[model samples]
Target: MIDFDYLKREIKKEKVTSFLVYQKGNSIFEYYKNNKQLEKLHKINSCTKSVLSILVGIALEKKYLTSIHLPVYSFFTELFKEQMDSRKLDITIYHLLTMTDGLDFPEFGEWNSFAPMVYHPNIMKFVLERPILHPVGTHMNYNSGCSHILSAILQKVTNMKTEEFANKYLFKPLGIHEFYWYEDKMKINKGADGLVLKATDMIKIGQLILQQGVYANKRIVSEDWIKTSTAPYFKTYDSIGFYGMHWWVNKLDEKNDFNYENTYYFALGFGGQYIVILPKEEMVIVITSEIYENSLLPLKIIQKNILI
Candidate 1:
């Protein structure tokens, strides 16, 4: 059993503003700096990517989109036709989902601090025109632009905005009441980032995945989609871990004395939002924090205390 009291004390000691943990569809623990007031919706940042991944899975399960193997250019000819090089035409939806589009866009640092690319009028055109740094599917680069393109593609195929599609397929089905996604200048949701939800809603997402896309005995997303999305698609940074369709894959070993069964995956956001799901343990840990730095420390503690 996990020591909720000890975990709460440690989190408070570290000055974490807000934290929530769910285990097997129950709120196992919660902590907050200002417990008197209701928690406000905080910016989830790049955690929106993981939400987009789920939306993509739902779209596929519904046949709104054809398949992941379809070339990205096939759907968005207007954007990719003359702008993208011939070599880039081979890029597929799978590559975008795996963050292996070969584009030179990086999510970190001050690259676009001077000018926000998401607000730019010709954002897709600008992204399409960037020189290809490597062959498609050959490398894993954390590119928010790739996710943006996916949002556009989703809009094109479904004939509805990504937010609308998500609301219809995902949010409504999951009974998520309060949430919002930021829209680009063209009024498309910035699927690479800009999603906000309460910490409890975040936990529901993890629970859905832990149950393999089933909620309340209903198959919201196909089991196959869940398995495929959570499976390792490509290697990210050598130091961090493997990337699996917008989810992070972590391996556990008995040498580490972890109670987990060697494999666990999680959805990570820029600030300190995590939706960690351990299928074997039937555990789901959802954490929302204001601490912008070293959010993974709490996750490590959970692994050490609860899972191990």
Candidate 2:
């Protein structure tokens, strides 16, 4: 049996604001440093990208987006009309979804790497203008700009802001209210980060994915999309595991294959925010924290204390 009291002590030492473990539709363990945090909308950071991935699947199912293979230029015709690079036209929705767009905008490996694109006068233009360093769709680089462009694409095709589209379809169905999604100067929702949500609401999202896009007996997105989006498309960083559309697949046991049923996958954020789903164990884990640097610390704590 897992030691809840020991886990709470470990989490508290690590400065985690919230921690919860849900097994078979029940919260077996929960911890919050402050009771007020239960009501607060904490910033989830890059976990927003995973949420945007779900929105993309929903849009496809709704027929707002026909296919992931469609070239991004098809959505933003005006943006690419004057573009010089022929390769940019080849970048598709699938590339953006998988973070294999080959864009040069780097989010990691440098201090404040994401700031340059976020602070640009026109975020979409900044992303589009970046030269393609790697062959499109072949390499997987962690780029926030790709996700932002996705948000822009969503806005273009759906004729609604990303926040509005999510509210009407995703959030409402999951009963996720009292949330905030920040937008750039262009007023496009930040798909890469800047989403704030309650920790409990995070659990609902994990549960939704756990049920294969179903929530409360309602089909929010198709099961096929969930399986497709969460599959290990590319081998990611050694420490980070695999990358699916925007979700992450991690093999806790080295011997195990990266299958949906065997391994755990998660939506991770920069500052220790996480929604970890272990399908084989029939469990979901939610953790939100304030540690900005050394973000992986919380995961280590979880593995040592809970996942063991």
How accurate locally, in lDDT, is each candidate? 0.77, 0.89
Task: Give, for candidate 2, the lowest lDDT window spanning 10 residues.
Answer: 106-115
Overall local distance difference test of candidate 2: 0.89
Candidate 2 deviant stretches above 4 angstroms: 111-115
TM-score of model 2 (CA atoms):
0.97
**lDDT by residue for model 1 over 1-308, one digit each (tens)?**
77877887777776455677676777767777686314566567777888898889998988988799999888878777686378779889999989888876755545631125665786677677778888988988878777888898899899999988888888888888788888888777887777888777787788888888998888889888888888876766654467888888777663553233777888876656778888777888776666566656756766777666
Estimate, for each residue in 1-308, the C-alpha lDDT of model 2 and write its tens digit. 78898888788787799998999989999899899987889899999999999999999999999999999998888889878988999999999999898877657666353447877878888888889889999999888888998999999999999999999999999999889999999899999996899999999999999999999999999999999999888885778888999999878778877665567789999889999988988899999998887788888887887676
Q: Which pairs in model 2 have colliding backbones? A: none
Q: Residue 120 in candidate 1 has what lDDT?
A: 71
Clashes (backbone N, CA, C under 3 Å), per candidate, total 0, 0
TM-score of each: 0.90, 0.97
